[model samples]
Target: MSEKPVRLAVCVVTYQEPFAHSAVCKSLAGLPQELLAHLSVVSVCNAAHGTIADDPVIEEHQAGALSYREVLRSDNRGLAGGYNAGLQIALDEAPDAALFLNADGWVEAWYLTWLLDGLRRQPDREAFVPTLISGARCVSPFRKRGIALNFYIIGWLCLRDGPFLRQLRFPDEFWLDGIDYWLSVKMAEAGLRIERTERCIAHNLSVSDQFGTLPGWRYRNILVSERRFLRWQKRPFREILVVHVRALARCLRYRRFDLAQVVAKEFAVALHE
Candidate 1:
């Protein structure tokens, strides 16, 4: 008898570019046959405007070693919604793990192989994120507690509150990773063991705020998501103050007073639903 090779759902969420020419497809097209045998791609697309629906690449990928499935919708549901749609389908097959990738990005084949080995070594981990490399920086291996608490909110403030950030190319994912942050808080509350990984993925800032505009609508969603998390954690008044003060300062500094207002106006937006 032999041990079965690990099966992975290489899940991607996208709203732009043709499916065949996407970073995910280009990478998949280059993968070795044996590796491809152990993988399936779950593509959740929010753009039905000929992005994935009419592309021949999905059929092409299905015809080869890779098994492919996609959920297409015209309505925009943000990142986590798209991820859930694809991951749910992938999970039905009981894959060993699901690797989520930024759709506007690519990962090296060796890193994918390394990730599988790491997953095998630590089968109990609830998740494993490759070091996300974009430009000269990366987001990886932050302590679990650091993210689950007010740090993410604080970072969002500092980035927006910075006078020069508007002119710089800062990544706004600190707020965008709210889904993962809340999950970390739950794991922390449960006393679950936390783990980290070293492999890397390159998230090319193609369709997102590559130039750090820090749009007002983005802020509203970010703050509302954090507000929901804080309430769920039953955080005290002062801890909440630490975040609000910084946010208020950013509002004044940017003259984007609407951010402070819309966070409440759009409180109905669901981070998990």
Candidate 2:
């Protein structure tokens, strides 16, 4: 009998950048047809303009490899709510695995292959992470000392094809990517094994980015999210400092004193809030 094509779902959460999201969907269409068969997309869009149907890449592919679906939202939950909406669709569809990708990331076939491999081998407990590359450096490829340091757009893989669970454990509250710090926690609760893959995916870290640019809305979101971030991801004072150390230095380098001010003021000793 012929091997069954993987029923994969790529769920993207995006805001105001249509082209960036298009690049992501393009990557999906660009995947070799061997892997693209039976793949579907769930675009949980937060902006009024990011209509997935109009993406040129999708037009070019004609949903060739990817069937598209959307969840248009106007909520402030940001990553949390967006992901919740996507996962809901995934749950209903009962796909083998769903990749929760950020809209701005550019993915490659090898990473998707890796995700499928894990899902095929152990769909119930397997959650794969692709090597995250930024500016030529491999960032957060593996679990560092038991904690993930800024997991890049390889993002979360929610599994359902296996025998363990029926649905994904969704994030409760996060603004933009304040959710990154909370992802592993939810995976742990869901009994998923976090696996690091050797394949690399380049994340521009430019579009739909917060920590890099901290645009007006993102900056304000940061201010709104700081207390909870400090509360939940509380670690040692030194570790917390180390996390923001680069952010602080960036403030001095690019003259982003505003972000620096927030970092210095908001990122103090971690305590129960």
Candidate 3:
């Protein structure tokens, strides 16, 4: 007898934008039936601008084969809260693997299959981060020797098993800014495997390009997030200092003094923490 297929669940947290929401739905709709048969989708709608859960685009594309659930909220609960809402529903189904996908990002048709295949090939790995396709020239400046850092996994696609996530506790207080780092750090500390590969791929909606004009709250989030991340990760003082220095330089080069201030403030907080 053949073995049962692994169950996969995807949680997409969306706020305001309907077009982007539909885009993700359409992308998922195009997945092969073999995968879709065991796939469940949860769309958390935190529509501060307007309603998107009822948008015809999402309704039409999120039908057939795959199981779908919608959690609609009137206020924007931020990234972590929105994802936690959808995750709660997905976890109830107890999927073999669950992915936290951003509403503005979409993976290729074969992304899920490739990731599952890789995990199957290497069963030890608990978490997988897909390569990001974006318009930004330099997404992260924190390079080790020459290789660039992988800071893009936070919002793109954080795919992992249910059991592992439950152990670490999914998306906590640091969810707003350093969520990706937090999860990666915890997984490493727990001796769980995390691998980054090109086979599984996703595309960002060029949102990082607008980092210069982000709201003040986002900068504040970054400050708070880094302090928490530094404490939890137990990174050396020199490494953290160098990273913030580079960050300040980058912000100034981009004429975003506001962001530079955020970097400085985070460094100051880190000193006390």
Give the poorly placed runs of model 3, Cα more than 4 Å off.
17-22, 47-67, 119-122, 133-152, 155-162, 200-208, 234-244, 258-273
Q: Which stretches of candidate 2 lie over 4 Å from their true place?
A: 16-21, 49-65, 122-125, 142-169, 189-191, 206-213, 216-227, 233-246, 264-273
TM-scores of the models, in the order given: 0.66, 0.73, 0.73
lDDT of 3 by residue, 1-273 (tens): 976577777878777654234666777767778777867887876764555444322342345454577766766666777777777777878777777776666667666776667556766767766666555443321223322243445544545665666654545677567766666555555665666665434353322556666765676676577656665656667766776787778788888887777787778876786
Q: How close is candidate 1 to the true structure, as a TM-score?
A: 0.66
The Cα local distance difference test for each model comes to 0.53, 0.59, 0.64
Write one digit per residue (lDDT tens) for candidate 2, span 36-149.
Answer: 775777777665454454322222125455557766554434677777766667667767777777665666777777767766676445666666767777655434343554
Residues 153-244, candidate 1, lDDT per residue (tens digit)?
11101011112211222123332546656544544454443344455554543213232366676666566666666666676545445556
* Candidate 3: residue pairs that collide: none
Give the clashing pairs for model 1: none
Candidate 3 global TM-score: 0.73
Candidate 2 least-lDDT 10 residues = 52-61
How much lDDT does candidate 3 score?
A: 0.64
A best-first ranking of the candidates according to their lDDT comes to 3, 2, 1
Q: Provide the clashing-pair count of each candidate structure.
A: 0, 0, 0
